[model samples]
Target: MRKSFFLVFLFMTLFVRTEAIRIVGSAPDYAGQRLEFFTVADPVSKTPVPFFEVTIDGRGNFTIEKQITQNTYCFADVGVYRGRMVLVPGKDVRITLPPLREKSFEESKNPYFNPVDIWLKVNEGNKKELTNLIARYDARFYQLTDTYFNQLYYRQMKNYLDTVRIRLEREFEKEEEPGYQTHRHLRMKSLEADLLRTGREKVAGSLQQLTPQEWTQPAFSDFLNRLFVNTLSTESKSAAGTRMKMWVARENLAELSKWTQDFTATEGSLSDLILLKMLHDAFYSGEFSSSAILRMVQSPWFSQNKEPRIREMAASVQKKLAFLQTGTPAPEICLPSSTGTIWCSGRNTKPFLYLLFADLEIPVCREQVRYLKTMAEKTGSKVEFLIVLSPSQKVNNTEFMSSNQIPGIMVTDTPNRKTGKEYKVRSYPSAFLLDGQHRVVLAPARTPLDGFEFQYTDLKK
Candidate 1:
């Protein structure tokens, strides 16, 4: 009996924890606080969705263990103090967050006051160098875009872009680390995306010839966005005006597929990118009916392409479409109010669901929240006017609400906010609108104080 028990215990010990990721960290100043880790599911959305969370002990040490199978880009976020990290499968990663000024959080005036200093030591790994390399590449991309996008040397732009690409290649070859080849590709794509986002007409000619492997990169999506938008700018919608619709609206996927087939015949396998691009444009444009788009994405036309990556892109697109679609059920959003009580906003019987994820440290959040208050007053009590305030020492919810004389439901998130992750809020003061069934009508609802006031009016029409 003793021998059998010993053998069973040894077997259990050997097999039980082989696939889990162990994270250990110390943030002395943040004792008794929570630390949340998140990963990006889709680079297009680039919203950090929560994986798991841990609470710091009285001694300022914290440990977290999560069974994560996928290798992904992840970050540790504590409201104003956020630190980025890359999480790989079955790795034990130790992160040490150094102390910050206790009063830094209270300085509401310095909108750019960031206090977190991240020091990561991944056991038996080289993630630090890899992450730093990615950051450097991003910096180079932003620098090159800002430098070349508006220059008189547009004729020599191709040469400048080539030089940047070559530099990136040389840097990648130097480290040439395994498990990080995808990061390099992602960086290259970012550079390309930013170049296209610059919208210089000449950039279309200068973009490096794309490979099938790169079709899934964020840069590819950006380039596709530009291409799709450029094509839509060609035709006028009415007889009286020369202005064309901002997006090329079609009745169904058949029309979009026809265009894709033509573009592919000329550009070869770029049809795959074109298809993904169209899907992106549809979602980002918010011009099309969700049901129509969902039906098209679910159609076999996306799979008939024969390229596995394109098929995978179609699948990914479908997941997001389902999540943000008109009839799909919304996720639970239970967060704490100023009274330290959790406000489960979507649980109640409100006719409409409105969520405003705000960060008062940023000026835009403040502006939007004030504007939201004005709009919410007009919306009446039937609509759940829930303000999901992300914690900031600079902007205390109780003080701000009282000082501004703002009323209604206010839900404050803990330092490690699950609400932000739940909603996938990337932009400051993001707005979401849901139907009576708590289905997302507008994943990101329009703001009253738009920079281009007439833009929303035009879109609504």
Candidate 2:
């Protein structure tokens, strides 16, 4: 009885020790605003899963304690900055954010706003921490790349590449953390692939040996994503690619697994991951039939798969395959309008609906809004407009629409951009034309400024 009690105590103690990490920080410029920290769950989709959030006080101070089972790459998202760091288990981190630099109107409405990903500065007291070490390594790596860019990338100078690897190895030597080790290995391999212009098959040959634990490292999946970008387009030209095509056409998971074994050591999670990546790329590459790929991912095998990651990723990819296409049904959005009336998508009374994701505070979006107003007034109920705004846009949606005489339904998306994500709105002023049935007609329909009327006319007539 005493032994069992001791074992329980040990397990409970370990659970507490491994479960949570603490981050306390200050961002004077962003006081009173909410800051969110996230870790990438799947690199294929690169979707960040929020781990913690804290609203900064007036004094620009905040604290976050959240459960984290292992060391992981994480980032804090602010206005136009994404500060990145490595979070080590059981270690307390204190950081200071840079001064706020808000996104410009052009950037604010840009669906593809690439934030300046800077390293969060660890406090002086935590200068010797793992996150700081990773930041330093990254800084040195970039410096080396800048110094030898032409020679390493263009000239393929082995000496320069060797110098880089040697310096990095020497500086980060003796670090025994498995995540950190994987980071170093994968990062170096990425450089080797670039410098030698190695084929994807040769570069991917190393993946078969990586343990499942190693796959959890963000760096490994990131490298794999880079290695397989547009894989179908390249592979389709090869003889073996013909066999892959045949396997996918038949929706044969068994045959597909057999094919993947040629690249990976075993028919395991890693192989499945590579296969998923291929399917994702192929879905977009126009090399394979979309229906067939969708059916394959939705197969019963995915539901019965033992690996949770595979199942999760298959679901994510399946959603993309199902909705991101031009003809698929758009995700329903129900949001409160400026008039306090709930406005939901797919109940449009018109023959067509122009669904827009925009931020009225942005000049580009406002400009687009003006053009849309002019067009909507001229079209006169022939085309309904449903505009979704980001919560961060601090505008009186009612007053703005009233003053601007903006037509149709105007609503504010949730603070997390839930509706925007459902539509995969990456930039500002994204517009979609949907038929009465709510099926997408023109994904990313042209902006009014870009002669949208021409496209509309063709569709109308």
Candidate 3:
């Protein structure tokens, strides 16, 4: 009997209630796609790492079960929709997302639009009072900011900020949820930063008083970046922004190197933080250059800091830059058309290629197609034009081919972005020209309007 009891005790001790997270979610309108789960790969870098992914069934139901050890931000990504949950180990979360078909005001490529939409909904449900106050505060900013040059406008905005801060402090005293408290604190900080950016010196002290913990959160880090940049821009309006432009033109990499060094030395763990944010921004901004990226990694600060995530990101940027240079062999990708036909470079015998990475929502994409049609109509063009789009974007190749009378091949790539990454396609309407041997004649060749027809003829020979 003692031996039997020992066996049972050992089993209980070894397998004692393993902690895990389970999530069930539905997005009825977004069926037949994946619900990708991500975590902050590094807190400082704030990079989303693929943790787990599941396909939403035809019925639009999906589930995720992950063994976790601590509280974490579980970010969900769909085609164009995104959501986040601060999940504790052993908690089961049920998520419902609201669609944000918000009309984009600019030709923007911001990826945060999805996460912000879900975050807005999350605040509305869990912190209704704070949400309502912020709503008023946001709506009133534009209404009042037209008179930003006036001192009276500053007084009114300060009073409104004070009220928001008071309510947040009171809620903080009563609130016990760590996640909600973090959200509230960060939101308050964001408001403070906005005020500070608009020449409000009264709240400057509040901005300078951030704790180390707050400095690490992505939201807070973003605020600091904007504050640093906008504040600097405001100071350099000597010639109404032209002075700043000239200064930037005069000192290119040195400006970036100085910013990295200065911010890194500002506070604890911030050296890595500031540099990482700059690199991350540059990586996603689609304006990345080899020299700019090389200057960042080869900086003295990078050697002194030696952060793993920072080094990794720098290496990736470097590799991507080197890979897409002119004369390098382009990475080949196989994809399927909307008509379920497979298309690939290996099957192509054309002597030249006009490769396009585009989206349906982008106006320039359709414009480029019309230009391609005009070129294709010209005689003796021994080139193959192919348009590749992410499945995340709604595009129908059959409908596209029929509507535009485009002669090129249309293929849908997966949202994994593997193809896009390989092609170094950062934004919509990015074009490339390749020779018959699959070499990169032009990594960012040219748009049709740029007289790519001439380059097309040149590459053909």
Best TM-score among the predictions, by candidate number: 2
lDDT (tens digit, per residue) of candidate 3 on 141-181: 43444434243235545666676566546644665555445
Which of the predicted structures, 1 or 2, would earn the higher TM-score when compared with the native?
A: 2
**lDDT tens digits by residue: candidate 2, 1-461:** 99999999999887755657678987788888887778776766666677777889999999978776666778877778898877777777788787888787667666667898787877653546766666777788889988999998889898998999998888877777666666777888788778755453556666567776567676777687777777766777887788778777888878877676675444677778887887788888888887898898888667557888788878877876677466778788899888788888867878888887887777777788778777876665678888887776467767777888877788989977878877877777788888888888998898767777788887768
What are the TM-scores, per candidate, against the unseen true structure?
A: 0.57, 0.81, 0.62
Candidate 2: which pairs clash? 109-428, 110-427, 111-426, 111-427, 111-428
Model 2 TM-score is 0.81
- Ranked candidates, highest TM-score first: 2, 3, 1
Off by over 4 Å in 2: 1-18, 123-128, 157-160, 197-200, 239-244, 252-256, 263-267, 324-330, 346-353, 360-384, 389-400, 403-406, 413-418, 433-461
Write candidate 1's Cα lDDT for 232-318 as tens digits: 223233452132232234434555555556543433345544555556555555554555556666667666667665566667777
lDDT of every model, 2 decimals: 0.59, 0.77, 0.58
The TM-score of candidate 1 is 0.57
For every candidate, C-alpha RMSD to the true structure in Å: 8.8, 4.6, 8.3
